[model samples]
Target: MKRLLVLSLSLLALCAAAALASAPASLLTPDLALERLQRGNERFVSGKMIHPNQDAFRRTTTAKEGQKPFATILGCADSRVPLEVVFDTGVGDLFVVRVAGNVTYFDQAGTIEYGAEHLGANLLVVLGHTRCGAVTAVVKGDHVEGNIPALVANIVPPVEKVKSENPGMDAAALTNKAIEANTWQSIEDLYKQSPIMREMVKAGKVKVVGAIYDVDSGKVNWLGEHPKQQELLALTGGAK
Candidate 1:
């Protein structure tokens, strides 16, 4: 047991060293912030989490100086998908918004805009997760009660899209496809509906990418950036 613990510590140190060895310039660009999160998750999945920025010092510093999170995460409210733990970020490193299925809506867009436009988040991640209850509910057409039903409705379009595309695809495969579809659609909703976010994307100040967290494996699979977002980010200066 003691040897195992020591080995864990050694592995943690190695992951931290690798992350720091080629650190990018100050999380200023969306690509750089994405890379930072990718490295952090690598440490997490390898069981080598440094648990960076979660210390008393970090807590105190964030409290005293206010938050300046480098990334904004729109993730599911699933307890299993604890945003900070999955990304291995800590106090003030991530501005997170959680709702079932990680769907984008008006209020959610406002919150994300505040994070990016005001808080200076260069990276925006629309994170869906595997075996997501919300997507499952929609796929199964469950009779969920109350406002929960409305919440599940948010994920239905993606299911329909997946169904239309895949025809007689199996249930498990359909759910997976729906989750990916939902992730990409949320990214599109954010970029399309929010003029503030659109301007930010055009300026290259923010990049919105889609990802899905593998619930069973504790790994986040980055599904690449949105295409319109790609075109927007490629343009320099002003929102045309």
Candidate 2:
């Protein structure tokens, strides 16, 4: 029994070492990483997905060396919004953090900073989708039980803002508007709340952008245009 246990331990150690030896090297720049995802999404919608980098070899390499995902996605925990399938990315391509409504408070901000600083991810995406249950629950003011109320409460501000801004708008439009606002609000909160993320964006080491996924169409609608290197540098006051 003792000999068998020793052999098992030795094999486990060897596997760990081999995995470490095959880890990925370097990462794409923020803009390029975003473009790669964009292309992947386009391919997905167009029915031309190549399903790149999802093979067993890629999995083994990531498990061994560690992950160096180029883009970090802060997305909703909604089941239909599968980040990998939507972007058509494989293992170690994306560092994803999920929460209801995609809101960033203390813990979520810390998680984003981990992807940026620790994992060396250059792109951060706050991805929200249409018909999200969390946001809808807030809009409806449904009495949820347990800790869920606290989670849904974070979305109320945006919903209220939408109500105030568009008093006559119907419920559907209001929810949609609020969803966009909530997504951007989370992006801004990350800047205001986390010094690491703020500094990284200022230093041009990271780019944070907001996007919306249409569940009906399988399309990602970025709130603004894609990041231009010149514009980004100018916006950051030439921090890089």
Candidate 3:
């Protein structure tokens, strides 16, 4: 047990070192990173995108210097929501993980940990969309084929919660509310599943926020941190 603990600590230190070695000269704080993403989304929404960091020079520079993305996004795999294009960012600007429903399972949480802990990204965004098919399926309890049920299993609880809480809501309203609830559920799953992310967040090294992308308006509606962020952080049982 002692040897295993030492090896785990050693690996963590090595990962931290690699991250620091490749980190940008000026690392953006969590708030600043969030602001940058908001500004980029504004440009995208207004059709005034400057297309930052897409140029050959920027690509070559990032390739040489190594990628140091400022924000890590966990978004839905909806074809309509192109994360970089929606955010108006370019090469090496954002580290992204996409899965249907934007659900945070063990693998998703671990990948998010890599992006935030091992890649030095302080801002973590869970980007769901306004009308997500995966969410819709879960909301309606649609019959799914092989493997798909497993994919959207995590969404069931949130959808059920929404239904139980909003018994008077119509189908459309229930679906809409469930979508938002699922986003929060993903954050909860992250805090529950990934100790790495929980510690980083508790240590003030990472911030996890949620957002919803509107496919029609091309705008990202930011939802800030979870309402019970402090409670979530407290689960880490460590210092900030």
lDDT (CA) per prediction: 0.83, 0.80, 0.85
Q: Write the per-residue lDDT of candidate 2 for residues 1-240, one digit (tens) a residue.
A: 999999999788656433332334263567767777787788788886667677898889889989888889999999999999899787888899999999988889989889999989888989999998888888878889998887776688878888898988888988899998888777766665676776788788988888999999999998752334233333332112
The segments of candidate 3 whose C-alpha lies over 4 angstroms from its true place after superposition are 1-25, 236-240
> How big is the RMSD of model 2?
12.2
The TM-score of candidate 3 is: 0.86
Query: What TM-score, to 2 decimals, does candidate 2 have?
Result: 0.82
- Top-lDDT structure, candidate number: 3
Winner on lDDT between 2 and 3 is 3
Per-model C-alpha RMSD: 4.9, 12.2, 13.8
Clash pairs of candidate 1?
none
Model 1 lDDT per residue over 119-197, tens place:
8888899999999998988998888888887676668887898898898889999999999998988887676667788
Cα miss at 143, model 2 (Å)? 1.3
Pairs of residues clashing in candidate 2: 19-64, 19-65, 20-64
Q: Among all windows of ten consecutive residues in candidate 1, which has the lowest summed lDDT? A: 231-240
- What is the C-alpha lDDT profile of model 3 across 83-143, one tens digit per residue? 9999878899889999999998878888888888777889999998988999999888789
The true-versus-predicted C-alpha distance at residue 20 of model 3, in Å, is: 21
